[model samples]
Target: MTAADGVAATVDLNGNFPASPPGSRSKKMVRDGPQPPADPTAVGVKKSGVLWADLDPCDEGRAPTVNGGHADTASGANGANGANGANGANGHHAGHDDGAPDGVPAASDRIDGVLEMLETHPESRVLVLYTGGTIGMVRDQSGALAPLRNRLASRLRSSPTFHDQEYAKRRFGDSDTGPLILPVSSEGRRVLYTIREYDPLLDSSCMGIEDWVRIATDIKAHYEQYDGFLVLHGTDTLAYTSSALSFMLENLGKSVIVTGSQIPLWELRSDGRDNLLVSLLLAGCYVIPEVTVMFGARLLRGNRTVKVSADSLRAFDSPNFPPLATIGINIDVDYRLLHRPKATEPFKVHCKMGSNVGVLRIFPNIPTTAIQSFLAPPLKGAVLQTYGAGNIPGNRVDLLEALREAADRGVILVNCTQCTHGRVAEVYAMGKVLWDIGVVAGADMTPEAALSKLSYVLSKDEWDLATKKEMLRCSLRGELTAPARVLADWDDLDAVVRALGAKPSQTASLLVPAVTCAAAARRGAGPLQAVIDAGADPAAATMEGRTPLHVAAYEGNLEAVRLLLRHGAGVHAKDRFGRTPLVDAVQMDRHEVIAALRGSGAHLGAANPALGDKLCSVAAVGDVQRLESYRLAGTDLCQRDTCGRTPLHVAAQMGRSAAALFLVSSGVDVAAKDLSGLTPAELASAAGHHALANALRSRRSNFCT
Candidate 1:
């Protein structure tokens, strides 16, 4: 905040992130029978090891979310959204029981759902979770389950259907499964596409925590290198996987979308094509920063999403949270629901999660271990999910000790309210107790923020107890609001007006006024001839700061200054800031004005609050030629300002090139320094004027230097 140091703007990641393939591919054939398509509404269902369901309603041509109402479905021949999963080195699973219900669905029904999603959310990252679905499965020699003969990359390459308007054609190329990976650019941001078949021998049904961990790791590693992420996850446990990842990542500034389809791609009429396409579009260009799950056309927060129906395509719903965005015919992003990164510092990958961290959901009568386990030594942090405004069930001694001990040990204990509208700090005394004991308050911060904050803190190299406590008290983002109050006034109008009106002694016409006043007092004819020529009463002069004579005096007008003094104008009259005419003249370094005042016998050195070092700088830089007239008037040459910078110091440091030669020739010290410890020579050198510097360095005339 200081003048020397300003705030740093956050960095933007533009050149980084992955890109898609370019060009077309030749047709490739696969000898495989398509499996029955699963009902989109089925829950916990996996068809050919793939899950496809309509998670939420969508807006026109956009993904559906909690905030947006239903978007009209689109009708057309749809193109894949061009979203590709990371390289899946582990191959696709084969012969797995496709999680579809017993009925065969027309391929057109599935495609219709996907087309609607693609049209609704045109700009998104669509991850096609190819978990050996109907299209991927083919019979091996042993009649066992295995991926079809053709690779997904080769399939994408054969078709030029995937393309975004902003991408350069050269930036994309053919893929292994025949589906071209198209890299799109928007407003300088980029996203890359590649099928998940990089894992040449794995399947989604066989996916475990390690697989999820790997997927999350890949996303995190590339996050700084990219703006968003899209994951191809099996729909069987898609919600669980999404929720797990939502809780895992920290300070996620990009989007993480998990999506898969119900039917296989090679079917006469398949839903997988549109679903994969829509998911890809949603993941690639949407700018909301958070974790999301895309099924059919709808996108939901990974953690908040729940699979509601077993067969119908629209499947996921965010019960307690609003959808960050909706894509049906058009993408409508709700900025409010999305979590944005504030620092833009850089995306950091925190692969390690303190699995030991516990969450205690407070109910009316929870047992002691619920609180006790949180304070245990092994625990790094705890999310004390409390009622509205962080109210505890009861202030038990055990609970208090658990909370206090956790905080004292540098374990960040966060208080997140059960209610949604307000934060914990505003309503409860219990919240204050936690704060007093060093427990951090999570005011209005979503569970996401609390979890993310805790992970961010614990992952640091230095987990200092004091630092953690301080970090919690301060805001990382402008999320918290402070109370407002009134401030006191410090007006200086009177002072400024007085300064404006004051005049220096050099302009004061006092002598002539004194003569007239003397003549008047003696009852003389007031010099009838003198009075006539005088034109007006010289004694009728201004003593306040605004006299016409005072104006001339301060301006170094020696002729006018002397005329006023001679007219008997008072010299001791003080301006509003208590400055006399002599003080004003001396402050301005107006030697002629100073000389004129002294000629009239005015006080030379008196108390004056208005005179300062800055005024001396003005004096040093002002008209130095006025100094010659002062000498003729027999004025003192040894006078100094508050900083002990005499008129000579002013003449040497700030004196003009011509005036400087005159002053030094007249015996002024050119090397003289003020209280700032800067000599005239040093000042010239600092200013980078080489000639002036050389002049100051010459020892022959120390006066000029």
Candidate 2:
């Protein structure tokens, strides 16, 4: 059997046919000379001439036949059989050849079959760009495996496991095209995809900035034609390509999935089939918007991924981030984790990627000369993989001097963590040394992300060094975690809060103290202590006589309340309405705040004539312990407030699940009508708490029981 026949026979085809001599294999033609770099700024080994292959007609027109049906007279006959198919004797049966040449199938019959497969209108369309990878690798005459353009699409077309014939015919009626439509039924939605193999397929190791730019440009060229895109790339530098693409494509509103496999698709137990199938499904059905890597049943942010294994099928991981979606019996996407595109923003490609970046992994007893040489001229930026939390050797003054010299020469250095997880924190003494010397903290950015981001940042020639440095620290396309803001002083804190557009306090005289105290309370002990030490009164009261302790308790700031109590703040201090800190805590349903206050000797205020108000406050806080205490103290749970709202009404309106459940369990009236003549369920529904509304409805039946 010819090699092509050998390769084709390994696939599980659905129909049966008499085997014939294999057709001619497409010649792998190498392009003439090295192609000029696509991006002017791209600096790397120039790619060789494009590998060219004739388009395989089988991919676009092959049709599945039933039983021992006659082969399409238009298409060529089946290639010679090799060993039995992977599915044993039931292995894909080939159609019987008509009155055609020994190895050639009739073209007219093939066209008729193709037309039949084109019956169904696609629900969704994905453009798969097969750049080149192990997924398409085939053994050459020398028996060495190498990527053969058009081979991947051919294998997928011939495989019944991938292109289910019976499922397609049942779902989609006879059409103009053969069963060429690849369908992925996910979440009850079917996705149809087409593959466009790149001419001169690339080995990912040879991929550079220009290739990334080319891919981005291709997507831009076809952005409006398809719903999403899938890139078949080599695994070696797949992460780098994905990372680069993440930066290159800005405001991408559709999924761009990069996937590959360790084993070739022709292998009996290859991962390529699943990877390709999943990538196609994700690209066609999901709106991930960002470039992502879908592999081993996990969809990760493209820029966040790193190839962690060379031999395992689960070869990639996002060390510092979680997978955006996990594939199981169902595709479970974390919608909250997805980055939604702004409606006002249009998708655009930023193809100008700078390639003059390098990575320097520091090691024990590493020499200063090596660092200087690596950071020499032409290298615009470098990712410095440092020790834990971005620390370097403190004793290595020479190495520090080398880094300082590089920084002085305008070489931007990004300090990234050597560890897979955690971030580069400037806590260690050596870490501070790097920070002081102008190294931009890479935060939790993966090495792939850092390197690509640096290249992207440096490509912006119009921006000043300071701006580039700032952008490096900032998260442009969800590549890195932005560092937490550390307020320098109270003024800085106030400025930030004001920027949030909070309304100013109404009482001018008490406004400053009240706002300051409230802000401190929200920030917990650190800022609260700073404010107190800065001469702000711990006992300072608002116009409503609400002190810092009351605000702290209402915010559930246990540490802030403790700090206030330790600073001689009054435990029984009452607000303008005669509400103590404990009352405020109860009103907010802050159990921890109440526990802290109760531990500090704070007591529930004396029984007021407004006993209904106290009960509602207790219910609003959802503190069952506090509610029990009030019940034991003879406060009626069924008491109605001035508005005739019961504790249950308040709990429902607040959407306090815990309190509502507690009230229901205590047999409080679930049918109790509020001031508005609405039951707890109605009140919850009106408040847009559907889950709580349902719960209340369920409990109402229990109450009847």
lDDT of 2 at 7: 16
lDDT of 1 by residue, 425-499 (tens): 735677677677776777665554455556555656575766875665554432333332221221333344346
> What tens-digit string does per-residue lDDT give for candidate 2 at 201-272?
988888888888889999988674455789999999999999999988865656899999999878889898
Cα error, residue 168 of model 1, in Å, equals 14
The window of 10 residues in a row where model 1 has the poorest summed lDDT is 70-79
C-alpha lDDT values of all predictions: 0.45, 0.64
Off by over 4 Å in 1: 1-192, 198-213, 220-228, 234-255, 260-275, 286-291, 295-322, 334-340, 344-347, 418-426, 429-437, 443-449, 469-705
Candidate 2 Cα deviation (angstroms), residue 54: 30
Scored against the true structure, residue 63 in model 2 reaches a CA lDDT of: 26
Best by TM-score: 2
Residues forming the 10-long window of minimal summed lDDT in candidate 2: 44-53
